[model samples]
Target: MSALRRLSLSGLATATAIAGVGVSTAESAPPPEPARISDVQQAARAIQGMTLEEKVGQLFVLFAYGPDAHKPDTRNTTLYGVPTPAEVVAKYKPGGWIYFNGRGNVESPTQLATYSNQLQTAAINTGLHVPMMIATDQEQGVVVRIGPPATQFGGNMAHGATRNTADARTAAAITGRELKAMGIRQDYAPVADVNVNALNPVIGVRSFSSDPQLVSDMTVAQVQGYQRDAGIMATAKHFPGHGDTRDDSHTALPTINHTLEQWNTIDAPPFKAAIKAGIDSIMTAHIVVPSLDPSGDPATLSKPILTGVLRQQLGFKGLIITDGLEMAAVRQQYGDAEVAVRAIEAGVDQLLLPPAPDVQFNAVLDAVRSGRISEQRINESLLRILLMKLKNGVLFTPFVDPAKVATTVGTPASLATAQTIVDKSVTLVKNNANVVPLNADPRKILVTGWGVSTTQALAASLTKRGATTTVAQTGAAPSDAAIADAVAKAQLNDVTVVITQKAWDTTVTDKLAKQQKLVKDLLATGKTVIVVAVRDPYDIAYFDAAPTYLATYGYAAVSMESLAKVIYGETKPTGKLPVDIPVAGQPDTALYPFGHGLTW
Candidate 1:
């Protein structure tokens, strides 16, 4: 802290201080050896004295859940009459924690700091005094887990829509700064995946652009901004690229058929740039690339890709983290314990959110005891883990002031920065027939549904814009019959706004049929049918004949509000298509390419 402070002070003392830390200092006024050594040097000395159990503990990063965010993997069992995840920290003393749920079940900022501090206090109680790294997958707008009190920046696809790298940088800086202030020093973000595949289920708006160069440039800028501006470690993720695969790895194993050349040209540039830019961590994708490893193993468990490509070929010396091993991608085949051992053998430095953390930890421990995994391998990962803690300032600054949380989170400056990104990223993809800048009255506007919650979310945003918005009369679930009813109500409105959302890339026959029916019926009435895509922009390809089309790239509150504001001509739509939306004739390319957007 003093080193950073002194560097800011303008004086000859800077040179004096520099000379003091030099290899051979002046004999007359040699700097006293009373202070501490560098984070790297300190980490090196600390590891030598650690026990094998303690060292192995640092290899795992497990999830700690808030009440409302509990999933199948979260520990639901109570401990000491408390429903909190406090017991998990005490039992494992793992190297890190993944904080889910920034909304319900999470207390106010001050209480959140207290909870984090309490966890840290329990972790260091083992006498090793090691600090645990707290992290989140705060990938901006769409995948934001931390709620109010945190500025939700417009996501990566939004950044790409603006074609502005600085927007990406500033949003990341704000996110990282606030996260750090709340005791989280790491974020898994700035998705390096180039969303080249129009039907990519997982990497849609979370990715920056279809163009590799644009993704690479924006990725590097995001890393720099997060680390330099806010002093937090930003991880470049889904490495070896999870962009082109059609399957969602959360439920299935996705495959990328691209050869090494294709991977190098399209998928590898961002990882290379991230490495060169001093990114602290790199996350492995669970997808399979047969060209990289013919055994059909996913990249997370493939030695050739993890060791040969990422570490040896790419020259990334930082920590290598695996995507959540609990996902069906790896879990369906390899049991909890077995895959954990394989992941370590694959050259991964950390196992992220392994299902059954105890089972996985014990599996690796047994592997070491049986000589199946060597102590040397353990040392290599241990060294990286310890160094990361030190270099990222998690070692000395283990605790944060609970009272100061209010001043750091969701400040006016951060929210303003977020609104700027939103304002710039709400894109107008197609406005044929001048349907947008919808009539100033906007008194009788009908919003059709896909997902009821998302429909209501967009309706709320429209309502804020002084539009009399009504959710269509769709049944419990979106179906052809339900959409038929919705179309009947939509025809009564002065203008109908149909908001579409798509997630899974496969088996959408029913959805496609319903959407076609809904739009056809509404258009038959001769009322203006305005299509606003709240999710992936590619859904536009299914209904290209709609008189007007727009892409918000997300359905978040900010994204919806931006979409509504643009419709009212209150905020100019500046965002362009981050990915190509193919028309009827053009098969593989975008009808609207990158850097194409409009305003009325």
Candidate 2:
């Protein structure tokens, strides 16, 4: 054991004894040295010295239950029979931990930092003494895990509209700085997928742009900001691209029929740029790309795609992590254990969030012992993992000072930067009614829309701007009563602002049809109507009848305030359309072409 770890353990035992608890002989044993190899050769030597179980353990990044690392939660048990996150870490010895807000893994910045420190302490107590790769999908906008006191910046599409690489870089740097402050070392962000399909269900506002060059530039900038500027390992995700799929991998296995030429031209450029910029990791998509792999397997389990295309053809040298293993797309063909083995066989360096960590870990361990998976293959992944840990400061600084988390995470400067991006990225798509830049005299405005909280936020912003605002709550699909109430409210207001939210690029739903009906109904009132798409820009294509329209690409606090400013002429719209808005029900025709924005 290193002297520092031994001293820490000694102090712990002494404290326990002082509390009248006896110290066992097990507590007296020296712990292992910290995993802090500075070079690849040193990492290789450390890997060589590791036991087979320890080496296999380095391949998985599992999720455990409970908010506090040390607090036992019998209600939510892992497959390994562990009750606490620290126990899970000690028992499984996995490479890392992936946190999810839905899983009750995150609450606030200081609490999360404390949780991380506890886990790191548990990891050090184990035989490997390796620091973990603590990660979370803080993708900002819609896919955020940590919320509130953490500055809520707009997502990729919001940055895409700004058409500024510097904005992307600044956003990523701020995200990285905040995450790192909370002891999170890996961020699955700056999605590099080129969104070409208008009907893509999942990658709509999460993607930077439809144009490959724009996506490439933004991806490179984010990669540099996260990795170089903030010292966070940025992961360029959904590799081999998930932007063209009609189905979401979380529910179904989507198939992309991009020809090799088309894939190289459209989807490959952003990933190429990310690789050139030295992105630390790439995440594999669950979608099947026939052009890259003739076999019907998704990219997560296809050797030809993960090994041949990504590793050899594209020459990517970073860690290749599989998307969440619990997703239905990858689980459709094989059981959990078999899926884990196949992922290892397919050149995946890290298996993310296996539903059954123990079963998956043993499967890979048995594969090595049975000669199905060569130990050299395991060594190759371990070396890469260790190198990443070394480069990203996970090995050197595994724990964060919880006291500093609050000051570092959501500073005034970071919030200002986020607001600036939103202010610059709010696109005024149409102003034929000239209803925007509301008159100097206070006007009674009605705010109603799809998301209740988002619409309420907009109303609050408008209210702050000295407008007489009345808000009517609306659901994802407005009910008849909601529509009636909104219309009644609109009758009292001089101008009605409707906020529409649709994150998916899929076919128009019955809910969307009802939303369209609501907008048309509001327009029929003959009062000045302003339609603002707070989530997806394509929402305008569904109801183009509204004479005054705008697109904010997100509904974050900064975004809503910026939208209010644009509406009141306090901020001029400078954003261009990052992705083309296809005509309703017609993906081929453009209602608003890319880079289309009107400034008054």
Best model number under lDDT: 2
Model 2 local distance difference test score: 0.84
In model 1, the number of clashes is 1
The C-alpha stretches of model 1 lying farther than 4 A from their native spots are 1-38, 67-74, 78-84, 102-108, 451-454, 473-477, 503-505, 584-589
| True-vs-predicted CA distance for residue 371, candidate 1, Å | 1.9
Candidate 2 pairs with clashing backbones: none
In candidate 2, which residue ranges exceed 4 Å CA deviation?
1-38, 503-508
Taken over the whole model, the C-alpha lDDT of each candidate is 0.76, 0.84
Q: Write the per-residue lDDT of candidate 2 for residues 1-600, one digit (tens) a residue.
A: 333233235344333342232323355553554455447766776776688998888788987777898788874473668788888898888888888899888888988887887777677668676778999998878889998789887889988999999988989999999998888999998788888877777888899999999999999999988988899999998999988978899999999999999999999999998998998999999999988888899999999999999999989999999999999999999999999999989999999988877788889999999999999999999999988987876665576778778788889888887888778989999999677888668789899877767888898999988888888867667888888889988999999998887723345576766788788889999988999888778888867888999988888777899999999899899999999999877888998999999998
Per residue, candidate 1 scores C-alpha lDDT tens digits across 348-457 of: 99889877776888899999999999988998998898778767767656667666677889998878778778888888888889988865674788888565766787
268 Cα displacement, candidate 1 (Å): 0.1
